[model samples]
Target: MSNSVPMTVEGHRRLQEELKTLIRVERPKVVQDIAEARSHGDLSENAEYDAAKERQGFVEGRIQELNDKIARAQVIDPATIKSDKIVFGATVTVFDVDTEKEATYQIVGEDEADIKHGKISITSPVGKALIGHQVDEEVRIVVPSGVRVYEITRISYT
Candidate 1:
């Protein structure tokens, strides 16, 4: 579909696992909970019934969301990619021009973006600036603090 979303292979697999768990475990448990709540007599004043219905709604909504995401996911494997220039799923080591420090980051899809883990979204300021650039290329990115420069020292797909 035109609305497809890029997702790393690992991220796609994790999503699939969550979906499976929801369907196999969460769904059945919610159903059982609702059934037990209904047996408590008088659904009008039963807090357990209300709570179970709310949980059911949440589970159903989450299931639909996960299904949609999985269906539209464009799984990309980083290990299979090869390029001289920066591209999605590329793990790049860089040197900060202003701070004289070094850091490494992986250009990844939005769903897999985790700055704490060194995985950045392709649409992020630094990621956008680094794309299509090769080693030793200086990339300038404007963030909330200020403009920061980075020199691409290395690029690896694995």
Candidate 2:
């Protein structure tokens, strides 16, 4: 059985837009390129044909991948979830125990994970450790470097 994919409304919309672009623009362009390449003299000696075929394969694979992800997506609205505890789509403020630095992260799905943007995947080590915890709770997470402790300072949704 496939695990449920939890994603915010914005994330779902982004995926839909990507799929639309691939189908409407990329697919047709790749097909035309392949057809044009095929019209050239010898397929064995044609670099254009090989390149076009490779590009077609890549585009088709991405299209299928996007379709599968969209099909399995379980859209969840952040506003609807109660503010009792930290959960998926929650913006959490944490204080690093070692450095005493403050950082905030919004728990998100794998597809939407962008550390620079502070959108962390719920499946990540830090996110997994923060799940179900409440504000003021101290949590320990194991990173590639080592285990680090973080104290949850605040939680918000937006």
Candidate 3:
């Protein structure tokens, strides 16, 4: 990409680990699978060969994609930052205005987004609404499901 991809140190580390696995473990195993399939001799009728070739293509494509992401990554460590306003890497606790409950979400990069784990991408509707907001601030965000209202309660590095 022409622009750097913003991410947390943890997200960067995860991508690097995936890349390393694809290169060291997956690449060699796929290569061996291709060779073994090739030994079957009949190219057109070789289903194993076709499957192995497809797998190789997938692995190679993922490796290249991961390499590009890693090269363009702008890693930010949350633990190293201290900010009152919600920003990237900030773990925020929000009180739902309608649900009468509170939920915590970490503002993270796209690759680190996992709603199930309470990590929301900075570009997400809720995350966009939360940025630059401080504790006790009310935020209104329009999502695909509907509009959401949240009150910022806490902000933590971790």
Candidate 4:
């Protein structure tokens, strides 16, 4: 069985915007660049032509990838998600048992996860460990630093 491609509504909108920009703006610009480069003659010796072709290929590939992802995306709004248990789109506050440090992270999709922003992908080790757990539950997750225990202090949708 294949896993669902879970994504927040915002993340999905971002992807859609990116796809639109690539198709409407970037694609046309690259095509124009290629045409202008071709006018220089001698395609084999033209550096601009080569660069433009490479860039065009890259843009097309990215567009295809984004389209595929959007097609399979399961957009979920955080505010609409209601559950006491930890799940995707849940903002969970965890207290480190060993370090006595508290940290909050929003469980997000792979495309939207930014560690610097305290957003973690649902597929991550800690996220996986927290899933299906409720507030006050102690979870032990195996990380590169070794096994660490964290108590879920709070869970919020927003």
Candidate 5:
């Protein structure tokens, strides 16, 4: 579909796993809780029933969201990519011109962005600036902290 979302293979796998857990485990647990709460006499003053129903709604919504994400996911494998310039699924090392520090980051889809692991969303400012640029190219991007310049030192697909 035209509304497809790009994501790494690992991101897709994680979503699938969460969907499985919600359907196979959480769904049944919530159903049991509702049943037990219903057996406790009057439902008018049953706080447990209300809570269980709320949780069930949340779980069901999450499951549907995960399913939609998985269905629209365009999984891109980094290992199969080959290019001299930066693009989605490329791991790049850049030297900060102002700080004089080097950092590595992988340009990934929005769903796969994890800054803690050095993975950045392709739609992010830095990632967008790096795209289509070759090694040793200086890229200047305006971020929240003002303009920052970086020199691309390396690019790898794997």
Candidate 6:
């Protein structure tokens, strides 16, 4: 219920790295490109200037977004949290009730949710359903594909 965003320590580190790279490397490069493009004259006819301006806009927007997320982040270390029931930063293994397939996912922040990497956002449908659930409990999640039931097989803090 907190307004602060929950993110794993690794996710926070990654965001810090990206912010550093953008401010130290990309920002200056974009500024130089803009200046060089402007020197070519006729701003309306300059494609390089237009492209550079567009890239600058995107870069600035991303920088602001990263800064906000980092500032509001509540870094959670999974290894430090101990819980038998599923919670933020918990890694849960689930068995599909229909297909009988098993899958593992780590409940993470919105920015760290990469399904291919087995990380899901706590705000996600499945993540929300799994929260506070215990091992062997069945969870019903309504996803875009439709409703699916999963049985919690295991829960771990790390």
- lDDT (0 to 1) per candidate: 0.92, 0.92, 0.94, 0.94, 0.92, 0.94
Q: Where does candidate 3 clash, by residue pair?
A: none
Highest TM-score scorer: 3
lDDT of 4 by residue, 30-142 (tens): 99999999999999999999999999999999999898889889999999888999989999999999999999999999999999999999999988899999999999999
TM-score of candidate 6 against the unseen true structure = 0.96
Model 2 TM: 0.96
Please give the lDDT score for candidate 4: 0.94
Better of 2 and 6 by lDDT: 6
Native-to-model Cα distance after best TM-score fit, residue 34 in candidate 5, in Å? 1.6
- Residue 142: error of model 3 in Å? 0.5
Q: Which ten residues in a row have the lowest lDDT in candidate 3?
A: 1-10
Q: For residues 103-132, could you state the per-residue lDDT of candidate 2 as single tens digits? A: 999999999999999999999999899999
RMSD of each: 1.8, 1.0, 0.8, 1.5, 1.6, 1.5
The estimated TM-scores of all candidates read 0.89, 0.96, 0.97, 0.95, 0.92, 0.96
Quote the positional error of residue 62 for candidate 6 in Å: 1.1
Evaluated at residue 39, the lDDT of candidate 4 is 100
Candidate 2 C-alpha error for residue 140, in Å:
0.8
Runs in model 1 deviating more than 4 A are none
lDDT for model 3: 0.94
Query: For candidate 3, lDDT tens digit of each residue in 1-158?
Result: 46899999999999999999999999999999999999989989999999999999999999999899999998999999899999999999999999999999999999999999999999999989999999999999999989989999999997
Identify the superior model by TM-score, candidate 1 or candidate 6: 6
- Residue 97 in candidate 6, Cα distance off native in Å: 1.1
Q: What's the TM for model 3? A: 0.97
